[model samples]
Target: MAFDSLGRFGVWRSYTGFTPEEAREYEQLGYGTLWLGGSPPADLPVVESLLAATETITVATSIVNIWAAPAKEVAESFHRIEAGFPGRFLLGVGAGHPEHTGEYRKPYDALVEYLDELDAAGVPTQRRAVAALGPRVLKLAAERSAGALPYYVPSAHTAQARATIGPNALLATENKVVLTDDTSEAHSIADGTVGFYLGLTNYVSNLRRFGFTDADLSMPPSDRLFDAVVAHGTPEQVVARLTEHLDAGADHVGLQVLGDDYLAALRTLAPLLAARS
Candidate 1:
């Protein structure tokens, strides 16, 4: 299936904040996919808008929250996009954190039920993915959807997820990056975004699972954890760190550039990443 591919690298960003022009520019820069974050709504007009703007690049929802976006409605949106844009849309869904969702309960079971609904609604399994973190969900993602999209994860977690999902399932890992040579500045910039995820229990637990202690998960996130989670340094240094996911078994690395000028950062790293390829 065409939806099964995301090349070597892609861009991950908040879907609502993204513009059609930026999507076009991303496509021009040679990113194979745009993994939209921030839990898009069921209608997915932005997905369609970006698809309309570009001819080839894939637009995948990093996740549509399973609780917020009903399966039937999301399926309809999937069908609509598939009809118009063919294989350009990949539906990524997840059971959001308990900290944020009031209705979140028995997340694994809810995810299974959501997948069932998507199946009944005729959404192809190969065209969807799950925002999986642990082994259980990673296995579920492989079995029920195309594969797993592990968010805010380190390379160690990526390696674990790939093993859990086995050799064939897609492993599109989201990696945060701050392109700068100042290590201290990078940590400061990353803390703004990474700090929020640290507050979420699921993320914290995963960090713990991979050996991050209470100190590492601290408010500012210990420098070691920051370095492990967010790639920072000069473009070359950041790219080297981001590629760690690929080495660890990620099939595609979604670069979530953290900075004021995302496009400028992307533009700077694009050639470097391409040269590596």
Candidate 2:
């Protein structure tokens, strides 16, 4: 919705890893929002735990797959969570990858239909957003929903999206961060994670649209590819990179730690972001 106080820094965690208590700890750690990833099914109980744990932080779905969680079911969950914890939930829904779902066909049409269903069910357009990347979907997101929650995109793309969606529409982007100074090792970890997304057509296409070529998108992503996608360095360096997104017109940037020790990473970066705030 109007993510007015969600802050610029947020945590991107999987629901399976973070318990409600852990979520509360993150809120205390100064992260303004908790973005649950991994296409969780429509279950308000899980959302409720997150809302109950934090007093003011917002809980959002990085995305609930439109294929798996139907609009009606999502709307029902939305109402339940809203009734229990008003103004604390933001629904981020997406048409998941075609390779992952049998129902993945004409995702644009599917998203439109889902939005129509959400509308008819009384879920306000301002309370939700779509996980959009391309121009068409991005434009549709501005028209039909609150704004766009674009994942795995860079600051350059954010600049373009900001121009396209105008200044008022929300532009929230996710950046993978590794708070390590070791360039080689950091890139290795980034490659392992980047490899999966590089293989996804939607991500690859978006990267190409941003000027990376087929050679750049080749297997075992080139150093250029890795650098463009992952922002790895010291905390200051990471903050510098993330600031580019905000400068490029992002309303908020969700920082996803690449390493296993997520809480430590959050603790490390919070102060730097706080200083800027």
Candidate 3:
């Protein structure tokens, strides 16, 4: 059950925004994993594309929405990826928000049911992770999946999630990132990156649990919350901030660098991350 294959850092982006070219570039930059963030469909052609473009990089879904993608079809795709690429694909599954899915009731039960179907279909439990944040889902991830893949969380939440899932599960937490020395620019990007997620009750509730007040959870989250959730500053400062997650027991920091020029930022961050290695 060791997560030795996953390494300590990876790039996180919505699959729709990704290209094979970027995957190849990340591989050259020495990143270990490529995480496709949005809830992608079950066919997993995007996963194949990224995997095909790089030899050693592992590709994972930040999450394939349980309500949008059926487990049986997803399992079929998992088999295809496994047969073709073996240990290179990780299926990160989750129950999406109630606001987004028409049938989003009982998220915890839905996640369990979807995982049950995956079990029936012979998708090895070690190959998948749960997009979990709260205690109930995090515990279920610990008991059932390879890890807890939590998004939009601070290092404090990462530490708490590590505690919730215990030591064995991979606590791969996502951190929104921006590289800027200007305080205004950093705050601008940080607030903008998490603006939409602020509306989701699930993310809001989780932040509240970690001591974020109602004001801190507002549209443009308070400075404290935004700073904690997004890694920003110079390359060295950003590296230091990202290092906090690893220190807090995260198996990997899923770097969702916020900006129009993501690759440029990744390039700037690559050397700093490598130095840590």
Model 2: per-residue Cα lDDT over 1-277, one tens digit each = 5667678888887766668888888888888888888898987447888788789999888899999997898899999999988998889999979878876799999999999999999999888989989999999998998899999887889999988887788888899988898989887777778888877889988998889988888877887877776888888998898889989999888888887777788888888987765
Off by over 4 Å in 1: none
lDDT assessment of candidate 1: 0.89
Comparing 2 and 3 by lDDT, which wins? 3
lDDT tens readout by residue for model 3, 1-277:
3586676889998889889998999988988888898889989768888888889889999899999889999999999998889898889999989889886689998888999999999998889999999999999998999989989888888889999889888888888889888878877766766778888899889888888998888877788888888888889999999999999999988799987767899999998897875
For all predicted structures, in order, the TM-scores are 0.98, 0.97, 0.97
Among all windows of 10 consecutive residues in model 3, the one with the lowest summed lDDT is 1-10
Model 2 TM-score, 2 decimals? 0.97
Distance from true location, Cα of 217 in model 3, Å: 1.3
lDDT, candidate 2, equals 0.86
Residue pairs in steric clash, candidate 2?
Answer: none
What TM-score does model 3 achieve against the real structure?
0.97
- Candidate 3 residue runs with Cα over 4 Å from true position: none
Please list the residue runs of candidate 2 whose C-alpha ends up more than 4 Å from where it truly belongs after superposition.
none
**Model 1, 1-277: lDDT tens per residue?**
5533466889999998789999899888988899899999999868888989999889999899999999999999999999999988889999999999987799999999999999999999999999999999999999999999998888999889988999989889999989888888887778979899888999999989988999999887888888888898888898999889989998889999988877899999898887765
Which one wins by TM-score: 1 or 2?
1
Task: Name the best candidate (by lDDT).
Answer: 1
